[model samples]
Target: MTLVLDKLGLARNGEVHLDGVSASFERGSLTTVLGRTLAGKTTLLRAIAGLQPIDSGRMERQGCEFGLLPPWRRDVAMVYQQFINYPHLSVFDNVAFPLRQRGVPDAEARSRTETALGMVGLSDFRARAPTALSGGQQQRVALARALVRRADILLLDEPLVNLDYKLREQLREEFRGLLTSQSDGIVIYNTTEPAEAMMLGDRIVVMHHGRILQAGSPKEVFERPANVAVAGIVNDPPMTILHGRLEDGRVTFGNDVGFPAPKHMDELSRGSYRFGIRATEILPSETGGVIGRVEFSEVSGSETFVHVVTPLGEAVMQLEGVHHVLTGSQMRLSFRPERLFAFNADGEGELVRAPTTGEY
Candidate 1:
């Protein structure tokens, strides 16, 4: 029910890829290893799959050691960014290949292959050659093949990257179910996309520079990032980091604008503080304290992000629906004090909530 990585470390090309990384992958839940490029997301997955050497670390699953085992000896399957399937093989053949190699009976392999294909919505394409399928369909076939193995652990490394926007959306809605279908197995996925991490990660392991930044539920890490690095990568438009002075629980910005300090930050000494707020938390207001000039606006489907230049710094405010605001126009951006996240110089921090009303 658990795959434990104890003091895991990996080095390559004279550089460290995973430095003392550690986390437990629990069965029945999707654990997402999230980070940007060169963050070791794939390296970590490969190490777990026994494809990459663990320079210094021990990996164990179900109370058994797997550090010295070969990849084929591990009960794991991986789907990659590239849809890797035999060009000459039919979808059904590809999905059945793993079972065939394992010497599974014909009837059992057929049943399991059909089941896996159906899980990926590829049952209809079973007879089609992999070369005839679209990229998304090919990826689905890869997923089906992996699922057919019924491995104890499933690894997906940016499996949706090659798909178009619409296809990505279509499969994202189905990925969660397919990945977690095996209640007794573990699904460990890796992605550089934070929004996707939040969408599918039941337990998100925030990683960067081959290190484990943080691990918690999606809401836990999103609501409270361990540092600026994790906070910077976890949001869609990214959190707006701002520098200001804190005096008597009040932070004053350079634009001569100030607001009550977060209640959670009451214990802090009056001094310089770095914090952040999500784009969606800030808004345009009539009496907003943080003022700025409209830089530009971007319309992303149902949401509109208004970029503004303020005395505090450049900030982005996310709003719903279309915006008629002209660029270069002045606008008042409101800061929701309670939504503020306080962090140290290193950017590790948590949300600061206001005191509950009528508590006294």
Candidate 2:
């Protein structure tokens, strides 16, 4: 079964919420809608759930018009960023609420609720109220509630965003197995974090400025981003874009920085191109050609992300372990030419050449 969206568009108060967005979602697959805030990820999910009305669009599920149905009539379930649960009901009752509303038999409802709670590791908390649970446990209850009904379509809008980092990581690790188990339904998970999107998605739908930017497998999108915009969105620290020129078999960034073009870019007839390299690819070296001054540094967990200003442009380097880099200190940094991504210097910055090496 397939859910297809055609030219979906929505606007409010002169602001475009969705700009001709279109994509196909297949059952049994999880598609992560990835984008920054106000990128219309939630708007897209709301449209699918019939909770948000679109000014122009056609939604078809299994060849039948789907947008015309009311929210209650759609066989869809949604979990929001917040830990939303029934305060008055026990965990078991909260999960069984939908089934009860549908007049499902008490025996079958209990069985389904029990199974859902167990799937989320919440079976032991079935007798407790949502208020008595931790943030993570409450979110799990929300998830179990969503799963208990076995809805045809499942939408999760940053469901783990409210939790602490450790809890988010813990829940995210378990989410893939739990979500993929719903192989008979269409699951769409929305997230602003590129890491979460890449980790959880079977396929990724990249969105920006209310438009569909790119849609493909996580590996495909990461290895070969559609354009500069996609490259910026998919990378955690954002890829460093340097305005450069390619001529005479050499790529040059500024007058002093030049290197022989990698083999992947040999076929390109380029005058000017934008070069991209990930932060992790840039390394500090004593004999490096690029001279940069440390602008600032951020230490995340065991890794340090150093921001530096160079003649070419500002760049970020991801170094393993903790390193205290002083601001305004001169540092030499280098990156392999073969790791660079080349893109057209004009228009949307279309990709000219991707790195030959698959590792990024």
Candidate 3:
């Protein structure tokens, strides 16, 4: 289904929740609403599902108006961050609840329920009670229930937040495979973490302060954020942005360090600017442009984030595989010119691509 959120506005207790959110989800793709807490990700999803009444704008699916339709009336299914299941219902019954309510034949409902359970790897738990399952298993059961409906629009509100890292990683791949292969439906997922959005979304909407700040592919947003807000909030540890000046064809930092300006930035005269680089892209070497001491280091599986306090400021470096980054050890960091982003005084960003740059 082509799900479109048209200028949606909502409020609760006299406080604004959704401030004119307008976006569309194309069929056969996953659109991730990426933002932090209280950024209106949940509110936008509820509004699209018709659970939260919009004060102004309307929800449209496949050219049909949904302002007057209730949750059941819309061909939609939602899996919340919280795992919700009927305690008294068996796994089979829970998965088949929607089909039963729609009065589907017992044989067809059974077939569909079993298929959904199998997709979520819960086929063997059909006869078990919801409470008898582990938290991860129960969340999978809720996902199975949502899938059994075969709704045109599938809404997942941070569905994997409660799962352990290993399981969440496992399910992220599963969700992308299942949802992206569909040519007749779409999945709208909300996430507060950039890593989650990068994994699950074909398209990502960067939301902030109850508004969508930017929308693009994961690579586009990650490599080239729209503004300072997008740069600050999209990453796990966030990007390290240093305010500096564009002077004499070079961008000058706090220390006596400078780098040649990119093509797009050449037009502007020497003035105030902001330069940023992601933690992962900060190349560390024995002798580099910026120097700092290792303040902290953490290892997770094959990845390591080493915090360094440079003359400019403190920044985290994401290194692949585990490295013995001893604390208090001096470190030197350098970055490719194209890997850095240059923003004007007004906060508008210029996306820098390797061997080329563009003013966005």
Candidate 4:
């Protein structure tokens, strides 16, 4: 089955929620809708489920218009960010509720409920109430409920966001297998996390300010972000954007930092350009030319993300292992000229050239 959205737009009280959003969803494929909070991820999903009205747009499923259909008449199931399961219902009954409501045979409901529970690793907890289960277990129950319906469209709106870090990671690993089992349905998962989106999605749709920024495979969007907004969204610490000039076979940032332009940029005309570099690409070195003062540092897992104020602009350096640097301390950094992503200096900041990949 194919679900196509054309020119989806929604505005409320003079504030736009979704602006001219358009995309196609295919069955057996999982699309992750990625954006920050209030980016309209939930609004889009609600519109698909017929819970929210659109100001303008058209939705077709297999050439049939379904945008105007009532929520119950649509073959859709949604899982929210919160653990939305019935406290009074046992895990088994909670999962079977949808099938029971549809008047499926008792025997068939039992079989489908058990299968869905088993897929989410909640079979052992089938007799337990939702209130008696852990957060992860409760979420599994919610997921099983959605899965049992086997709706034509499954929408998950940041369902794992409320769990703790370790639980989120564990469930994320399990979700890919569980969701993919619904091969006949179109799955759309929403998230604010770039890593989760990249890890779980077959295709990713990036949204910003209610607009679709870019949509493609994780690698395509990561390697060649459509614009500065996309680059900011896809990277964890966000790519460091530097306004620089490429002139006389040399690339210069600020007043003192300069290097010979890499061969990949040889074909381009020398002028003003915006350069982007990943935090991981910048390294601390004793002989490094670019010196910056550390503004702040964050240590996540074994990696340290150091924010620095350099002459060119603020840049973040992602370092392996934890290194404690005092705020205002001087740190010398270095990066290869070839690793920079070149973008047009125009207002839109379109990508001009991306660094060569796979060699490093």
Query: lDDT per prediction?
Result: 0.83, 0.92, 0.83, 0.91
Deviation in Å, model 2, residue 77 alpha carbon: 0.1
TM-score of each: 0.91, 0.97, 0.90, 0.97
Candidate 4: residue pairs that collide: none
Q: Model 4 scores what on Cα lDDT?
A: 0.91
Which regions of candidate 4 are displaced past 4 Å? none
Please report the TM-score between candidate 3 and the true structure.
0.90
How displaced is residue 159 in candidate 1, in Å?
1.3
Model 1 whole-model lDDT (C-alpha atoms): 0.83
What tens-digit string does per-residue lDDT give for candidate 2 at 1-360? 899999999999999999999999998999999999999999999999998999998999977899999999889999998878889999999999999999999999999888999988888999999999999889889988898888999999999887778878887888898887854799999999899999999999999999999999999999999999999999989999999998999999888888898888899996999999999889888884699999999999999999999999999999999999999999998877889999899999988799864544
Checking candidate 3 for backbone clashes, the offending pairs are none
Q: Which 10-residue window of candidate 1 scores lowest in summed lDDT?
A: 351-360
Worst 10 residues of 4 by lDDT: 351-360
Using alpha carbons, what is the TM-score of model 2? 0.97
**Which ten residues in a row are the worst by lDDT in model 3?**
351-360
Model 1, range 136-192, lDDT digits (tens) per residue? Answer: 889889988888887888999999898889878887888788777754588988888
